[model samples]
Target: MKRCILEGTRIWQGDPEAKDTYVDFKGSFRTEGTGRVFLRISADSNYTVWVNGQVAGFSGCADYPDFRRFDRIELTKFCREENELRITVWHYGIQTQTYLSADGFLLFDIYEGTNLLLKSDRHILSRINPFYRNGYCKSISPQLGCSFFYDATKSETPYQESVEQGPGLAHWREQKPLRLKAPVKAKITPSDKGYFIDLGKETVGFFFLEADSPEEQLLTVFYSERLIGGKVNGRPGWLDFSLEYKAKKGENRYLNTFRRIAGRYLFIECPKGLNIRYAGVCPTDYPLVETHRKFADPLVQKIYDTSVYTLRCCLHEHYEDCPGREQALYAMDSRNQMLCGYFAFRGSAYQRSNLVLISKGLRPDGLLSICFPAGMDYPIPFFSLVYVMQVYEYLSYTKDQSLLPIVRGTLDTIMKTFRSRIEENGLIASFEYPFWNFYEWTDLSHNASQIGRTKEDKTPKQYDLSLNCMYIYVADMYDKMTGEHTETEGMKKAIKEHFFLADKGIYRIDTLHDRYSQLSNSLALLAGLGDRELAKNILTDPDMIPVSLSMTTFLYDGLLKTDSGYRDFILENIKTKYKKMLDAGTTTFWENEDSILDSKAVESLCHGWSALPAYYFHILEA
Candidate 1:
């Protein structure tokens, strides 16, 4: 296949030194007959396109420039003999977990059938947005990416008019159009703060508002995935995702296109006399049809439905971990998401794209980042091993051998990377650096000392049982996927020899720690190091380190894999856990039970990794 490169467009930048900048580009084209118009668009970080002040399209491909994806939007509805198009591109200059920040650039081409209409070049008028100043640092999580501060008082409405001068231009090749779906709106309620809207579910998209005020007022919009104390809490760590809009008197309508806000509830606070005509969310997600899978149990059905909804919310431009806090893609999260998607949504394209995107994120040291298309690099060694498992899963579901060639080098590199890290005891040792040795967020008392440790802690664990077990699992997966075999027998033998506590009939956390976790034991069972009896015992153990929300999927998976008869028990357990979330008024699965721990807050109520019950339901039914 020949790669198509952008010929006429040059990379554009508003300010060379600006960290987080917004650039606006405007161009007009006269159609000869106006039968139909198509636009090919791509931006560095993100972009939204408007035609005659109406949203024509919006997308930001999660990839590097060389392999950048572009959206081919059909503007037939918004087209006329004489038409104007405006594009707003956000260039987040700082490095983050999700976005790979680079120089600001916008590449686009317009066409009326075969004849070219207008292309993004020096001729087009472009300028920096004067109104949108970097306001408060409202980052839900440092990994998600930066938030936007729109000062509507500074200037005119964006996307409503074209600017005179702007940034330079950039060139990019065209890919497939982004999967688009109609935005879903939610119900609104009146409150002292202002209008409170409940999406009835979590989603990732822009906030829509229509209102009228007697006098000029500042409208503050607060977004949250979970409500605390029966109200939306904005202060979660350093994340206060409150966007202020300066509204003129009389009537006004607005949609936040600059930043995609993720939440299930919106608190729109305004001054007195500000009549909110309508307040709702324009929910966005990957284009996937609703699942037809059904269950007799209402609790199980609700869990399955909410799990599917959670997966949908996380399936935006990429498979994000959570739409509210960190709209970043983690290999481990996506692996689970892909598995659930196979049974629920049954889509393969997005799964393939996610796998390829992560494969492209392999660093110089043969390790993939915790997330891809990201600016700053934070590699989780265990996640890299999971990447191998994810690829195998993708192949198992889609049976698409095409991606194998693309990720062949990446697979080999990862295997070699892990192989080099193996200790003398045949187990993969924890790294010396502070590289996020996170397995699961177990209770503090269970594994208190092992929970949070810095690289400076010279105390050497004999071996990481969970990490080595995952390696063994992936090695076998890799061997099965490809023809080549990896010598994982020694690693499996070492896990039993070094980490297994025979007297307790369970696996320890490691040789150094006198503690054990469901995570390590479950991985041991899933990786074939432990038997069904051990798995059953671990599943029923009350004294063991409880499985966190994220690791619950693995625990259940190990249980089901160990003994098919435990299916009913697993299903009932899922109902017991998720019923608590439902009772707590969650429309989707949570990041963890931390939200319920205190009436004050929760991390994320709509996490993708927690959507594993959906997979289990489908797998069990089959």
Candidate 2:
């Protein structure tokens, strides 16, 4: 019911380490309606909210980056008549003071129509207190000035993490070793002929030039409105931009398989001729980021990350392009490069090889494999092979020696982790658990087959053919690095015996009975897991084309290794699939060959795994 809602609170920063603390503020509001209520809250990071007796909402222990405002939540679900909103704040800290305000932490206004129905210090409550806060209280405000009571030094402090927000970027959560880059010196100056603005590439977010000078610079960024597009001299600004399409001076540019990556922004004053020319270039090969405000907004990234997690949770999809499909795919190489570096430094080799895209946390425990049916829940060593391959490929392309220490450390870590997982039968288990389809299969359109489950079968799940082959490839790479044949020969022999079928081109899975899957067939070639000749035949197989298309050009890669002629054919196919996806209005990669438009239907959006095509496209071009 398109009900208008503007909700948030303003509060003073309090020394969280004080007890019996109170903050009082006065805000006057008058409203009339049959069912009118204001959801008010002082703060709710791991706390609860109450407006009179009705419950508002409960929050988990969160690492909120700021102390200026309260959560702006929709309270339409909790609106009540005769609004006497009272908030009870609880603190688990032994030496912290919680702040309470009458205008709330911010002013929240609610209306049923033009009639201002309910106005309160806060808007929206958890309706129920979170059980996390050990203690509770009643009646905290309206004193306006002195609103706290607690031993400022001995009060328990609310727990917090350092992932806070910024102006044109997300919160700077020191990514282990690398904190967010320092703000580039952006200076705009006026020249004699025209205004020369030197942002010095502080172009982290959306920037538009309104006119030649600050007098005509109509720049105002509002958080509540997601509308980021603006006008330059009363004309469509960003939409009117046309680029020369190349990296600017003094910028590092990266070319991924499908996109280019560069860090520069240019805002040109429109010329007053027949057509005003505004030019800028985004080096990535994927879609240009639509909103710099969003990219720079930590809240947006948090929300986007939530969407990515939701998709990962629903289906075990781990490809970067699934959620922010194009965006993730474009950033895959850079992101993984960083991830590989981070894990390498952390001494977690188990994750070094897993070409994990976006998952839960940046730790070994959260890495997932690229192979489908592997899903986001499972992490296998094969994906590590892919990751290492890409890392080497990027090193070769960029010739950046800065990554050497990381690469070497990662190889060492992967070897150690894989050694522990390898069974006596020369096979490494996919995850901590044996293969028992962790979750039901979700299809391309985000629909479930709804297959009923049976008892967990433990018949020593036949050695997965694709996985074993990838092990051979990675083990071989490891041998190259260490100058010793460490487990490569054994893995290779097992792959050939168990995975290679005389009749079918490749073994889909390790079953005594031969069954071929497009995935198993393609990965066999991609991973260099099977004989070169057979891998080529499988790629051109008529039955495999749909599956191959579904797999995108990720498999086109193996064809380059096997048969050079497949290059043109593969590129053409990539174009065709790109067009098809565009036709389907698909912004990201699909789980199957359908349903790419339903945004709510979850699939891994930041899947660094599936974004291989973007990287592959770059590698092939190179």
Candidate 3:
């Protein structure tokens, strides 16, 4: 009988400050007979698995230090009695939007027919990966962490020992392994500086390349969702979508499991001598199959399929706002995704898991982080209130009352924070310094988008219409969930007392400004501060400030709440709006309608929030 341990041993690179650290581990164990083999593994950041010399599986769920999740990988097909295992783990030691910095470690467990054969410890051979440069930490975006520089010319180092670090603060739990798909490749086309590889559509994936070079060929890969001036504009906006790799002489095979590129085009800048055999990206999707339902109208059905595809692209470990640039989870952005996901997909686990992940992002000030597990402290007050609504809707749809108790404290904290901020006018004032008071991309919330990253707040404090309306909405949800009394009536009264313009049949932006926006008006109607007549008026007002693609969900919801027959209006509106994207041959929807003609061309083409037609087409059949 073989003595075995079920849990894997945790190993670290021995230094926490070794940011952008990548380690390669390999070990071998002999089995007496052929049996089912499995590997249970977890890591601080990300991990990839290989059996013998063939690729097997890759991905560690995005987790907080308090709750580190592991993946269970089956390797029966790739293994033999005399077997070798290789696992490469890249730990981002610094905090970013989706990833939180934590103890950098890797734990491995191998099992054969329930008999544990191997586990990670100092006994397992490991060394710092020589191919991937360790310290050259260049960022693709502040939101999406770091870019990689791989040098194939660099020789592998001698196997060394990995220091044993005990299981960390996070409780260990097994998770469903990531779904790996076949790599999507493109024929290389000659361009200005190099060759452009277009995959025909946006794909959230890992870079894979198999090529041969006459001599040492240094290649710079510039990738993007769309082309500017017929060239791949890698750094379209605040993003630096580029990677550098040194190809050694002869054949070179690389499957970059580190940085996940979300784009249709990859432009490789290399000399003429390099011969490309295969070049593309392998998509890693959240393992959830879609239930297809085509509409009567072919255009509507086409839009529905495209919207569903957009939602699929954004869902990896969690619900990312977009797969292109900012692969982070924000409450406001995810609220749209969740509502649409309720109709598009069958399972509720992905939505529930995302709600839990966002719950772990609470700050000391009682607001959720701008994004989940984000290192920075730029909390959006409007977005935080949306969390309560999201939680209610999630629970309401699933009837999963169990989740409320888990997230009840978060709900309480968020409500209290906003309630306490109510000023003499009976409305919550705009959040002070450090807290971004952004409502939407439009000038509705004073166009806070102009203020990029700053610690100072130049905007004055006034009772903002959107914030107060959201507070009322959240307070109502809080009251219903907790069965506790809230000052929601007073808050609603104050909102009407200050911002409502009865004659104009709309709400003002704030006390400081006379502006009115579709977002603010929609929120007011949804919160029951207004009635069906108000909804009809808001829909008709040509002068009301229009909403962006992100906030259109609320607009549609408000309209439906007052009148179900308004579904026809929503169906036509959606078909009209999303048809433009269909006409442009978009595989996924755009970030906003303005992105279609905008010269900047830096907008994300596959935004999850913009995929609301998937939800509408399901409920309000066109």
Candidate 4:
């Protein structure tokens, strides 16, 4: 049955054109002899729920308002004969790459067992927060959402105090229960800057601080996936994630709970004369049971455990590319994450939800965006092909056919769009539309291209061997899964004729570039465009452009397909590369091998896509 919003609550919006807005709401109710008190809470964009000054819960999973999610909390423990409830809703009025922002609103209901108690209405005392200066600052990673500025000098509002109110007037329907798990306490270490708390692993959550100051002071908290030279590198850049709070005199207790910040390390900087009592992170993640699969080798065991932990950090309301930076769901990233989930976790619901979410990103032009449920559209053409392959993989692993019907239309549209672009030679022509043609993060000079600065770079507009091979691979899977014919043979033949250098036993990056890349040739082997001998030579060639950690998953897959004996070699390679991370004291896999990148500040230490080795362990053994 479709859930409806509580009756009489009007959808609230401070300013329709405001990009960011915060609305504080307060309501009070009296309950006598309550067996159990429950609160069904939800809001547009996101919300944090507090009952009588104690943290109750939070809700914000990207979704359309019609299908908005609500969390059910047992408020019995916090409830009293006379009770007060407070909620702060951070409504991003504008959309972004990961969230579909809409009008600001909050819908909630309080029930005593089965008996009705309270529902959100206009009578609920609500006001636009004067403290939060929306649009005052921008986020380091735009996709991660906006930053906030709150002025402590401003007069404090009684937003948390109980108030007599009437009823709200908006209609709503209930959906799935919120998937955000309860927060866990993190481990902390003292540092010169302040104190560093390691959540033991990367996770998406907020910092919890309890301190007291003789005088007013400002506290700054910096977050990062990895430290640089034994210190938190919070410099302003693409990955800069931090927060600020004002500590009042006497007692200061607060939780940076509005945004779900992701990091393994937190550096708290307290002003002089402030007495620090306690500081730690309340780590948040999806409540998925870890698979108890074990390996005899301790190194392999650590790798496997780390991979599982990486996935856990990336799993929340959806599969994020990285918790520290974007926190957006990319088809390519989520595809790898889903494969790892199939082996490392117990259920398929999260994978299915992610697949369906990406499928919803299909545009009118038959192309999917780089991320789903986004406000703005940034299409990575090849990632659309990856979406098809991801569906095939999900079906193969889970044997769940129900998703077919759900994604069938989007799949058909993608095939039709690609088919329309195929030239007479049966290969896709250079993309004419504005789209990202990213394959991997390999050196552009090595691939004979001048465009590699940004992921959205568009240069060397010509037929690409890697993209065509990816298409062939997905087409084959589509044919096998749907019993629908795809022109995989024609694509394979075109790829061979145009890109493969028979005499050199290497495939060109594209028709225009004479350069060879591991990405193109390795994919050729995986798509069966080249033989095992060719794959062997490509794997051994030092002259070939090296693959990035993100693309190494494909390289390994291709190598294993060419020859099963490569398993030992593959395991050794995994150990060699991942050992560097382990030696560096990382509890999770990294976005890239540290040596390949000059700086550790930019690298995500707990990247989900890098967790492919966990999946490989299961497959190689089988």
| lDDT top scorer | 3
Best by TM-score: 3
Between prediction 1 and prediction 3, the one with superior lDDT is 3
Candidate 1 local lDDT, 1-622, one digit each (tens):
1344543464454464366677778888888874678887767767889899888887764886456666678887888889988888877777778777666677778888888888877777777777667424446567766666665546553333232223323323233344443456667788776877787766677777777878777777888876767787767666777777777778877787667787777888876656766666665556676667878877778889888888887877788888776788899899899998888875588788788778888888888876888676656787888899899988988888998988999999999988998778777877544455667666421233542565567765557778888888788889887888788888888888887787788988877876788888888888898787788669666778888877787788788777888888877777888889999778888887665564546467778898888888887772
Sequence-dependent TM-score of model 3: 0.95
Candidate 4 Cα lDDT to native: 0.75
lDDT of 4 at 619: 84
The sequence of per-residue lDDT tens digits that candidate 2 reaches over residues 1-622 is: 0122333322222443333233222222343444444332323223334444444433211122232222333345554444444343433232111112121122334455445544432323222122112222211111101111121112233422111111211111111110112233444433332323333221212222112221212111111000113211211221112111112122212111111111222333322211112222211111111111122434333333332322221111112232221122212233333332232122322122222222211225323332211112223344455554555544444455455554565566656666676777667544424212221122221112212222352334445555555556556656654465665566656566666776756664554446555555555665566557666667555644235333443356556667787767765665555455445433333443343333332232223333223433434451
What TM-score quantifies how close candidate 2 is to the native fold?
A: 0.42
**What does candidate 4's lDDT look like per residue over 1-622, in tens digits?**
2355453344453563466778888888778764798887667777887888876777665766445555667788888788888888888776677777666677788888777787776567777777777655456566777766554545765533223222342322222333444455666666655677767666667666777778777777888776677777775355557777776777876675677787777787875545666666666767787887989999888888888888888867688888777788999899899888898888887788778768878888899977877776657788899999999999999999998998999999998899888888888965644566677767641232422245566556589888888888888888888899986788888888898887788898888878898888888998897778887877787788888887888888898788888889888888888888898877778887873244546667778889888888888872
TM-score of each: 0.91, 0.42, 0.95, 0.89
Best of the two (2, 4) by lDDT? 4
Q: What is the lDDT of residue 356 in candidate 1?
A: 78
Clashes of each: 12, 74, 0, 20
**Residue 310 error, candidate 1, Å:** 1.0
Model 3 residue pairs with clashes: none
RMSD, model 3, all Cα superposed? Answer: 3.0
Compared with the true structure, all predictions reach lDDT values of 0.75, 0.34, 0.81, 0.75
Off by over 4 Å in 2: 1-381, 407-410, 423-425, 429-460, 480-484, 526-532, 540-554, 586-592, 597-600, 604-622
lDDT of 3 by residue, 1-622 (tens): 1122336667865475588888888889777565788777778778888888877788754777766666668888887768888888888887777777887788878888878888888888888888898978798888788899999999868988878888522333324567778888686887656778999888888888899888898899988888787788888667799998899999999888767889898999987556788888888887776787867789988999998899889877778888877788889878888888888778787788788778878888999988987875578888888899999998889998888877888888998887777777677777776778888778756456534745553666577888888787777787888898887788888888898888887888889888788888888988888888888777778887888887888899888888898888888888889988888878899888868576766778889889888887887766
